[model samples]
Target: MIQNNAYIELMKETKQLENSVSKISLRLKTDQQLIQAFLDGNKESIGILVERYQRQLYFLCLRILQDHEDSLELVQKTFIQVMEKLYTLQNHNSFKTWLYRIALNLCHNFLREKQNYNKALSHLSLESSGSFNDPVIQEEQSLLLKEFLEELTEKQRNAILLRIYHNLSYQEIAEIMDCQEVTVRSHFHLGLKKLAGKLKKCGLTL
Candidate 1:
């Protein structure tokens, strides 16, 4: 009986060790390693990168496009473009910022095309997709505020989206946007001020 208890303890310790190693491996897997794997013709790493970023990318696109179908389509195209340009990426650590830059440029292009075709939205028509009730009014308020943010100047719009929608800090936004952090902060503050004014005039306030 004593030997059986000792054997059980040993097995438990081995299982715990294996679990710990697995966790550490995932955490330790950097973008650099993943990029190297891709360069070495490992397709699985590319898939892992897509899995890691798909949701975040989707949300970012949705914030800009405000249409679920269009957002998903844009994200799919972004991933495809990323794959095509994988060889051109120099610094693996810059992948996130690079991806944001690409997606943002694509959105700008799309907006430009839409403008040419005279299909640009006025930003006030972007309604959250659900029945409005007293309970969810607070949540709707924030989304509407974000929608109003799209009306700001391009720099302010990008700064607000990067900071508020994507939850990036001013430093990260500056890096992705190729501007100084002070510029990003200035844009965000001014953008918020303009957004508040617009919302107040429209009779929509949280």
Candidate 2:
């Protein structure tokens, strides 16, 4: 009876050790490893990818859609599309840009179907006018900035958001926007110049 109890304790220790090692291995896995695991029928690998990028993707979608519920749905759609077509991804190193491209496409399709250009401007106008816990001057300046953004075209708005708000490089924005690098630079520069003029006209300095 004493030997049997000792043997059971040994087996339990071995199982615990195995579990600990498994967890450590998972934590150490690189992006490529995770992608390979996902391709090899490991659903948890996809979950890890989602967990890593969900917040940034959500904000990106939110800024584009300007509607919380729609943004959330778009993010989910982006992930679903990624999962479905992940095998088509030839370069794992470009995963982040590829993911952004997917999300941007979804947003563009959604906006096209809804023809919500006016609606988006209206929403931004309403959103910017809301009360904030900042000083009156700061709040007014922010409101003016949003109004300036509202005046820009969709391409200009997207270029400004991706480059300024999200800090994406021009090349990355070009990839995500499906445009040339020079085009991305042009859009960004033109958008900034327009915004600056608007701000100057309103007596607000950025």
What is the C-alpha lDDT profile of model 1 across 156-175, one tens digit per residue?
Answer: 87886677657887888988
Assess every candidate by TM-score. Answer: 0.70, 0.79
Pick out the ten consecutive residues of candidate 1 with the lowest summed lDDT: 116-125
**Candidate 1 error regions (>4 Å):** 1-28, 116-150, 198-206
lDDT of 2: 0.80
After superposition, candidate 2 runs with Cα above 4 Å error = 1-24, 122-134
lDDT of 2 by residue, 127-199 (tens): 3322345677667767777777777777887787787767899888888888899998888889878877886
Candidates in order: C-alpha RMSD to true structure: 7.6, 4.4
Reference-based lDDT, each prediction: 0.74, 0.80
- The positional error of residue 188 in candidate 1, measured at the CA in angstroms, is 1.0
